[model samples]
Structures are given as C-alpha cells and as structure tokens.
Target: MQNIGKIVVVAAAALSLAACGQQAKTETAAPPSSAAPSSTAAPATQSKGRECTADDIKTTGKFGEVPTITIPDDCDPPKKLITKDLSEGTGEGAKAGQQLKMNYLLVTWSDKQKLDSSFDRGQTFDLQLGAGKVIPGWDQGLVGIKQGGRRLLIIPPDLAYGEGGNGMKPNETLVFVTDAVAVTAA
Candidate 1:
C-alpha cells in the first residue's frame, strides 16, 4: 500500500513538471517581429493632436532611386489610408492576382523614422496584388498602380499591423513610398 501511494505521488509530480515545461515552451514561442528595422534611426516626437495631411510629408529623389522623405516634427497621422501618386506611369495599370515587383521605403508615422527599404537592399519586393500575403493596406493600395509609377501610401493602424505592430508601437500608422518596377499578370 505504501508503494502504491509513492507511485501516485511520482505520477503527479511528473505531470506537474510536464505542464510547466509546456508553458515555458509556449511563452518562448511567441511570434517574432515582422518589420524589424535595419537602421537605428531616431524616433520622432509625439504629434500635436492634429491629423496628418499630404502637405506634412515631403518626398524628394528621382524615380527608381532611394527617396528622401521628410516628416514635420508636429505632423500627426491620419486614421484612413491615403495613396498619392508621385509620378504617373505610362503603361497599363496593375490588377488583382498580378505579380508585382516594387522598390519601397517604409517609415513609422509616430516615430517618423525609416523602418525598411527595398531600394537600400538593391532588390525589388515581389508580391501578388490583392493577395492576403501582405497587410490589408498594401493589398488594397497597390492595386491599379501602373508599372514604373511611384506612389506614396499612408496606412492607418487598422489597415496596417493593428495592435501587433511588431517593431513599431501598438496601432501605429505606416508611411511607404513604393515604386513599381515590373508587373506580371496571373
């Protein structure tokens, strides 16, 4: 009878240890940041309680080159998605299910800092339009962009990463300057 009691205690202890190990593994397996910035750029000051406008963002540099984007110190971010064409393309516009090759620069609205740039890496990002592979903003905003066109997209948190912004603050907005390099229809 004593041996039976000892066996029961041992089984309970083993189950407890196994549960703890599973919990530790689950905690350590959290998803990694998706938009890890390559550059250690400084963060921008908080906005002055105003919404961001197109005038507050300035982009300079020729098409197909790395652009220099300037955001004002007091600039605030808007709540909706905004897409502005910097340079219009000459050919047919891109459609859904089409594969697109683009060079892009990404910046966080709250920090006004560059997060990533395909131009800096000297490679174009390839993705299919209207696909769920990317954020909702990119899937919606990149449609109808012509090949060789340059565009600026201001994405709100709902359209971006939402509460899990990864490398950025929670619910942070994003700014992107995208240059369409090539397109292949599906």
Candidate 2:
C-alpha cells in the first residue's frame, strides 16, 4: 500500500511536470499532496478582463467542503501579501509552530487558472505554521486563522514561489481560499 501511494505520488508529479512543460526545482515545491484534480476544465464564468481587487475574487462554500473560487481574467498583482478572513472561526486562532489542517483552493491571478485544490482530493493538508514546510505566503498569511474560518490570501511573487513558482508560471501571483478545519500544537 505504501508503494502504491508512492507510485501515485510519482505519477502525479509526472503529470504536473508534463502540464507545466518543465521540471520543477526543489525550492519551488508546493504544499504536500499538491496534485491537480482529474479535471482541469475552465470555470463556467468567462473573464471580462477587468482589474481585480480583493473584492473581485469570490468564494462560496460551507466550512469543511470544497470551496468554489472565482477569479477575474486578469488583475494587477498586489505588491505585498493580502489576507482577509471571509468567515471568522471560533476558538483560539492558529499560531506559529502549531499544526494547521486546512482545505484550500489555489488559483493564479494572471490567467485565473485553477492550479491545485485540497478539496478535490477529499483531504485536508497539514502543515506547521511558520515552519518553512510550505511557501512564505502560507507561512505569513495563514497565521491567526481560527478553526472553521475561511481566509482569502492574495500572494505576490515574493511571498510565494518568487521566480520559480514550482510548476506554476514564473512570478505568478497566487490566490488561495483556505478553510481552517483544525489547529493543533505541533
């Protein structure tokens, strides 16, 4: 079973590589289990090529379910990180050094492409806050998120993968809708 899991991981990596048309460097690795969903189909809404703001991005879903994220066709990427809590959660906020179990949907700001989603996999991604386990945007933006809350993060290149972008476009700004399912001490 472990071998099967490894095979699946390898196959998923290969598919991601093929989709991006290049090999991803180690420094650009995304969160664990960052596989693309079976379907890469475009969203039902077409972009009207309007400038996007934090308000332009929309999300609809209940906590613990996969969220639907809609991004405009094109937008000027923010120069700094922007974090907004769409729905506030109860209990203590997540802190650095704690483990966060989250469901997230990642999209690019440039072309509004869906890059990765934890909801599609029917699993939550666990990572230690500020542990360097993931990108800087996640490390910085995800702090203080309470359980059951949904947060929107608009990350510029510097806070994200920078020039590498892992399998993503170079210097791509990333839009993430993250649902904080749980938080525990690491």
Candidate 3:
C-alpha cells in the first residue's frame, strides 16, 4: 500500500514538471515560419498607429511627386528589412543579376531626412540587382519586384549601412520608396 502511494506522488510530480515545460514552450516559442522575413509575409501594417507603406505615410508634395515623408513617432524601426508593394506592376518581375532602372527616394529612419532622390536628379537610377552595387536591402527588396512597380523598403541598419553609415549616420535605418522603371536581362 505504501509503495502504491509513493508511486502516485512521483507520477504527480513528473506531471507537474511536464506541465511547466509545455507552458514554457508555449510562452516563448514562435512558429518556425514566422522567424524569418519571407516574400509572402504580410506587411506589418499595424506596427504603429500608422502604416509604414508609402501610400499610408504622410507626404508633403503633390500626389505622385517626390514628397517628403513623415514616420510614426511611436514606432521603432523593424529588426529586419521589410518590403511592401505600394503599387504592383504588370511588367516582368525583377530577378538576380538583372539591370534595374529605378527611381528612389531615400529617407533616414531616425529623422525622416531626405538622403537621396533620383527623381530630383531627373533620371532613373540604374543598378545591377544582387550584384553588390548597393546595400543588401536594395538587392533583396528589388528581387521580386516587377518593372513599373512601386515598393517601399524599410531597411534595418544591418541590411543598410550597418554600424558604419553611408556618409549619413552610423547604425541608421533607411526607408526607401523605389519605383521599378525598367528591367533588363543580365
């Protein structure tokens, strides 16, 4: 009879420990699918009170112009690069090693300062995608974009200039509004 009672107590303790382990997993573990940014991942439109996509962000100039941007005051920059399509294109999608002619407006994430504008220069910027001519964010963000599409890239520092900024500031997160004007085969 005493042996049976001891066995019951031991089983109960083991069950209690097992419950704790299950609880820990549920509380701290995210699904493997959500761990990395994928092309299919939905934009975190709910990140702040405002959406980070180009159309949702406040602009100062006329519609379709190279407008000044206003970032949400309460939101922190994302830890990973985020690509959101502001307007989808009907042309061929971009691929690695392809030459892309794009119009871009770059703004520093911290202060919303305009860093670069291809529109102001009155010419589309050309680069070979995934060929190291630009930051990793541009390479990755341009990969799946179609010609004539407008994309918004929210690039974390690591994907942009990293700890050493691109003559702007160190560890600066960059926001780019890019329009894929043309794509040529590699």
Candidate 4:
C-alpha cells in the first residue's frame, strides 16, 4: 500500500526546496534530532493587548482550512525564529530527537504565495525534530510543542534559504502554519 506518511514527507521536502534554496539531503544524513534550549534565546513578551506577542504575527482560520497571516504594518521580519501556538494540543508535548508527524502550509513572506501544503495531499508530513533533515527554523521552532497543536512559525532568511534563495527571493523571510499530528520516540 502507498504510505501516505512517506508521500507527506516528500511533499514537505519538495515544498521546502521550492520555498528555500536548501540542497537536497537524505533523512539519514541529517544532524542529531534534538535542540538544547539556549539561555540567550529571544525573550517572549506580550504585545498591544490581544495581539501583543513576540512574533508579532496574526492569523485567522479554522481547522483544515488555509489560514491568513498578517504581519506588522511595517512588514519588518523578526530577527529570530518566532513560534506561537495557535491551538493547544491534548497529547504529550514534542521533544527534540522525536519524529514529528504534521500537516503544514508554507508561504513566502514577501508575496504571501503558498509554496506548499500537506493539506492538499491529505497526508501528514513527518520529520525528526532538531535534525538537519529540515531548515533551522523548523528544527528550532517546533521544539516543546505538543502533538495535535497548531503553531505559526516566522523564519528569517538565515534560518531558511539564506542569501541564495530557493524558488523565492533572496533573503526573504518565510511563514508557516504547522499542525502537530503525532510524535514518535526516537
């Protein structure tokens, strides 16, 4: 039988490559799957009333639907990777080194064009958290999130495709809405 899970992983990889200029690498060659929390990480502070948060990202959408994201009026990208939990999960929180199964939508920050979405394939994308299997933004941003939770990630170019962009513009920030479907022990 066709593994929907594998299909999802390939879709995620292809989408990531299209959005960012990352060279293709096999999952086995990826770095270790765990990120140690850093003491110098950016501080998470509350913002202007209901919308005040460190990432400064806003969104509106329902489950299984594409979400619309709004950046600050100035449109300046965050310096660090920003992760905000959109919907809470009931399962155990994901840990570094675990394989995460998820559904995701990737979009370009400049034009807001969707680069990829697992929802289209009706499958769940899977990756080892903190491993080099994906970009630094994903490796770092997804840590500590619980399975079944939805999160928004705002990634800077350095963590994404860098100066040599993939299918996107150079040094452009990227946005993603990710749903954590499941987590497996490493």
Candidate 5:
C-alpha cells in the first residue's frame, strides 16, 4: 500500500515537470508570424510594398520630360520591392520624414554604362528616407527595405528630377545603385 502511494506521487511530479518543459519551448519560439516582431528582430521578408519593378520603372521610365532610364540587373533593384519594418518607416518607407544615410552609384541599363557616381567617394549622404529632401523617385523607390541593408533605386523622371531637372538638364529618368547604409529619424 505504501509503495502504491509513492508511485502515485512520483507520477504526478513527472507529469508536472513535462508540462513545464512544454511551456518553455512555447515561450522562446518566435512570436506568432503576424506580429511585427521587434525592430532589432529581422523583419520577416513577406511584405511587398510599393517599390517599383524594373518593368514598372522602365514602363514609367519617362517622367515629365526627363530622359529615358535603363537600370542594370547587377544593380539589384527589387523585381518587386518587399517591405518590412525597419526601426521606423512612415509608409512602407515611401512616406515623408524618415531619414537615412546611403551610398550609391548611378548608371544606365541600356549600355550598362556608368552615368553618375557617389560610390566612388565611399561616402554616404544623409537624407530623409521618405521625405521630399530627395527626389520623388528616391522617395518612392525606398519604400520597403529595413535598416542597414542595401537596395538599388531606379528612378524614372516622374520620380526623379523631372521635367526641368533642377536646371541641370530637362526631363531625364535616373537609375541608382543604392546601398542603404543606415537608418534614423527625420
């Protein structure tokens, strides 16, 4: 009779311990898929935002009166921009006021020729991510990337310098090889 009682107590304790082990596993696993997860947590790559495709860009390539643009494949522009949270973004990153530091080189896809460049400087320019601080194409192009990563920004004139092109030239589409070096607030 005493042995039977001891067995019952041991069985209860073992069952409780097993339940605890299960709870631990559940707690540590990544939060359910839908939650935005934390900022530092790498954003899941499932969200597609407004960044234009080479096709969309090439199609919309002519803006205002700028020039026709052609972006190289090596540029790495997203076929479709995939958006996920960075520490902060206004609208999938397209909205105004988000600030970022980046390194880039501009090129033409038609001849795969280097058009203009910033990468050669090994410098990063600080600009508002979604803000009008930069051109609309840049504003629209950066819509869906996280901080500390690189993406190619291809700007058609409509999204670029546009019609008069800051007086540098008139209506020309632009292509950029952007390295999103860092992200910060406006």
Candidate 6:
C-alpha cells in the first residue's frame, strides 16, 4: 500500500511540473510531491517606485481588513510654531546621558486620539534620548530643538513603530506636539 501511495504522489508531481513549463531531465526526479517547476523566475522587486504622498500612510493600515488606517490633516491641528529666539540646541542638543523634561501629546493618524500626553496631565517626563530606550522617532525628532523651544513632529511608522505599532494596534504613524523645557545630565 505504501509503495502504491508513493507512485501516485510521484505521478502527480511530474504532472504539476510539466504544467508549470519546467522540464526535468531525469524521469526519476518526477515525483508526485515535487514542487511545481516554473520556467520563469519570480519577478524582481523595484528599488524605486512612485513617491509616497501623505495619503499613502496609515495608522490602522496594519490591522489588516479589520481596522482601517487613516491620516487626516487635522491629526495634529495644523498650527505654525510661534517664533522663539531660543538658539537651537547645538552639539548634541540633549546630552546622551541626560534626562529631559518635555511636554508632549501623541495622536494616532486614524481617528486621531490622544494616545498619550505629558502636558495634559500637568506633568513632564525625564526622557533619555538615543538610549534605544525611547521610540526611534522621539530620539531622532528631539535632536536639534532647543530646551525652551516647542516643535511638532510627524513621525512615520518606520521610525515610530516599524512593524508592530503601539501596543494593541499595529504600528501606525504618529503626530506629536512637543515642548522641551529642561534637560538634566548626570
């Protein structure tokens, strides 16, 4: 019975390969379970494609059909920063070893929600930037802004969440209104 089963499998394999336009030199290699042979190799991926627009990004896009990702213009409430003469922090704005006191509000691109906030709570956090401790976007976004300056950051998922986005939801783009008020380096 086993031998019979093997023969049937081999026959199926040979037939599938032939259907795929693949030719086998040795009849012995024609097994029923053999993968279908293909005359054409898989298409190569393009290195550069059309440039992406704001519409292409999504916060819930990663949720797969279950959740929809959307980024609206009002995600962060469009507002130009008021001019402040504070010199942009230079030469390692926030010391690598230091902690920073910052006020921020993070919102999801889709159905904008206040995922997190520091100022809303009348509190501030001591963030250690570039310590692989904070989100990559935060580490990089907070780089040049001065301690007393406020800035807005539009972080793509690649820099913010990569693949698996914020807990519960898939990685999604985030918008932040951040103000740096202090930095303390030990």
Most accurate candidate by lDDT: 2
lDDT value, candidate 5, whole model: 0.37
> Model 3: residues >4 Å from true position, as ranges?
1-64
TM-score result, candidate 4 = 0.69
Deviation of model 4 at 113, angstroms: 2.0
Error of 2 at 81 (Å): 0.6
Q: Is candidate 4 or candidate 5 better by TM-score?
A: 4
Q: lDDT of each prediction vs. the true structure?
A: 0.62, 0.63, 0.55, 0.59, 0.37, 0.41
Give the alpha carbon lDDT tens digit for every residue of 1-186 in model 4. Answer: 111112223343444432222333221112211212223423334443342244566777755576776666444567678898898787778887899887777766666666656676576677777655666777778888787788888877677655422333455566878888887799
TM for candidate 3 is 0.66
lDDT of 1 by residue, 23-82 (tens): 331111012122332344335556588887876789987679899787777756888888
* Candidate 6 lDDT score relative to the true structure: 0.41
Candidate 6 lDDT score at position 146: 62
Candidate number with the higher TM-score (3 or 6) = 3
The alpha-carbon RMSD values of the candidates against the true structure, listed in the order shown, are: 15.8, 8.6, 20.5, 9.3, 24.8, 21.2
TM-scores, one per candidate: 0.73, 0.72, 0.66, 0.69, 0.46, 0.50
**Top TM-score model:** 1
Clashing pairs in 3: none
Clashing pairs in 4: 21-166, 33-97, 47-52, 48-52
What TM-score should be assigned to candidate 5? 0.46
User: What tens-digit string does per-residue lDDT give for candidate 5 at 8-38?
Assistant: 1121122243221123211111111212222
Task: Name the lDDT of candidate 4.
Answer: 0.59
Worst ten in a row by lDDT for model 5 = 1-10
Candidate 5 wrong stretches, greater than 4 Å? 1-95, 109-112, 166-169
Candidate 3 clash figure, as a count: 0
